[model samples]
Target: IEKEGWSGEVSGRRKDGSPITILITASLVKDEKGEPICMMDSFVDITERKFMEDELRIKDNAIASSLNGIVIGDLEGNITYVNDAFMELWGGDDISEIVGKSAVTFAEDEDKGRSIINVLQNEGNWTGEITGIRRDGIPITVQLSAGMVYNEKKEPICMMCSLVDITKRKEAEEKLQRSHEELEIRVQDRTKELTKANIKLKKEIEDRKIAENTLLKKEKELELKSLNLEEANTALKVLLRQGEKDKTELENKVLQNIKELVLPCIEKLKIYRLDDKQQAYLDILESNLNNIISPFLQKLSSKYMDFTPTEIQVANFVREGKPTKEIAELLNISERGIEFHRNNIRMKLGLKNRKTNLRTYLLSLA
Candidate 1:
């Protein structure tokens, strides 16, 4: 039994020899002499409450020992408790000094306001990113989760918070972003450089094509001049064969002068620096001069080989530097027929693979 207005819990031996715990509360009204009293009593078994309290203590210990930072704050935004991990994160020197301090005090300057605390007080919870400063003044980035706790009267008793450090992860992400930006810049610069180089290369190719065209035109002009000289030689030859003795010496002197002086001068001009086309024309003139006329002009060698009358005429006409048209008229054939005999002469003389002008090749055999 409990005395008036006295409350206590008692553990006693039960009939089964087991221990039992009880919580008893009572109120009483006493007489004037205070010797007798009217009393009311209420009682409850408190074993369950003890078990619940022990379980809560275990949970608290578990949270304290966790690797993450855990904090408890009062509704006034004062830090009421912090676990070991939280202290370690803050330089691990003094945790007692942190007690009763405002939770927002350790936040970075950018987050110095009690926005989270106010939210928790008004809405029973808040969570977000927070930049915090450690005890040694080191900066850290963390993910924070906080919620309010309430008492039976529905008054906010405390706020519980957990912090996960994400500084390393954030740094890695920043580095990757910077690297991506740098690579893009390099790609753009390289592309610009390549574009410029391509433009220059295109210009160079155009210049080369222009130069090649100029050389080709020069070569065609030189080939025409060579054909004219070959025609004059043929005409001179026919005139020499038909002339009387007195006219022969004058005609021979004229031919000799053309060959020794005028032709040599022209040959010197042919040797001048020329483009591809000009060089091709010069090659034609040079081959005909050396291979055609030089062979037949050798008096002693003329008797060693047989000559068809057309070949003889063609040879003698070319030796005197006659044009192909004059040679065609002398032979009483069309110019095309003259060209056909010239081709036959070229094949008989095995003058294949010579890029020299055809007239020049025929004259070379004279």
Candidate 2:
């Protein structure tokens, strides 16, 4: 028995036989002789208080455990609570460092923070992207969402806001937008080229139809003139021979002038000191001169339109019996690049996957 008094909380049963919590205070009431007569007791229900405490504890744990930054501020925009994520995001080492400060300290400016609070009060909820500052003075972009908290009586109390780091997401969106713009530009250019090609093709088709009709109209005339066609052919042959002779004479004179005038100038230009790039350009110019004089380039280029200038250079080096290392040094490319060009050239020349030597094939082209 407790002599002074006893006060504690204990589980009890209600009149309806359901469980309840009771806070009990008991003491002994004695006569003047100090002998106990009857015990006095008082009971009060504390179920609601226990329930509220449990709810508050759960809320605190949930807020503290959230992955995203969560902040709770007073009506005046002063911070009351901040979770670990919020502290880390603000470059704070402890909750005490963050709490009691204006929540807008991490925002872009005081005006921006005030605007957010104003919008939340008027609009009941607010969400937007804002530039936030860290305690170390670095800037970061965050998606912020805020809402007004209320009491059980539905009166506005404080503001609770959540922030998410969207820096990487924003970068990715920008990159994708740039790629989309580039693709759109390329598509527009290709469409214009296709439009021009379509117009030219339509013109060619119309010309072909007119030519066919003209041939039909001249068919009877041609038939009627067949008896004199042999004499006409003989005269056409004599005229063609005279034209060929004139053309040959002009070609020989031009070749002689180039050999006498252009060759000397080119040789003189080579006598000056030059860098590797300038020397390479000079070599290419000389190679082109040889190509113009020889029929090899015309024959090969006529067979395949897919050959690139570099591939042709590689092919020329291969034809001259230059090794891959020497060709790479001359062309200022890797040996692997030279080998790749050789393979591409061989594939274009229909010698891929065959035992035929690439150098021998290029020589045959020459």
Q: Which model scores highest in lDDT?
A: 2
Per-residue lDDT tens digits for candidate 1, residues 1-366, read 334377898877678997777898887766897755677778788877877888999998899898989999877788989998888888775778899899889899635448777788788877777889988888998888899988889887788999989889888989999999999999999999999999999999999999999989988998998899899989988876776465647646765766787678667887688997667557655654543335454431344245566765675566567778987876678889777766666666566566666556545544
Reference-based lDDT, residue 199, model 1: 100
TM-score of each: 0.48, 0.57
RMSD value for candidate 1: 18.2
RMSD of each: 18.2, 14.7
lDDT of every predicted structure (CA atoms) = 0.76, 0.86
lDDT of 2 at 136: 87
Candidate 2's error at 67, in angstroms? 2.6
Question: What residue pairs clash in candidate 2, if any at all?
Answer: none
As a whole number from 0 to 100, the lDDT of residue 28 in candidate 2 is: 90
Give candidate 1 regions above 4 Å deviation: 1-44, 152-154, 201-366
Model 2 ranges off by over 4 Å: 1-4, 15-17, 30-35, 136-138, 207-225, 230-366
Per-residue accuracy of model 2 over 280-317 as CA lDDT, tens digit each: 88987887767745667656765676999899778878
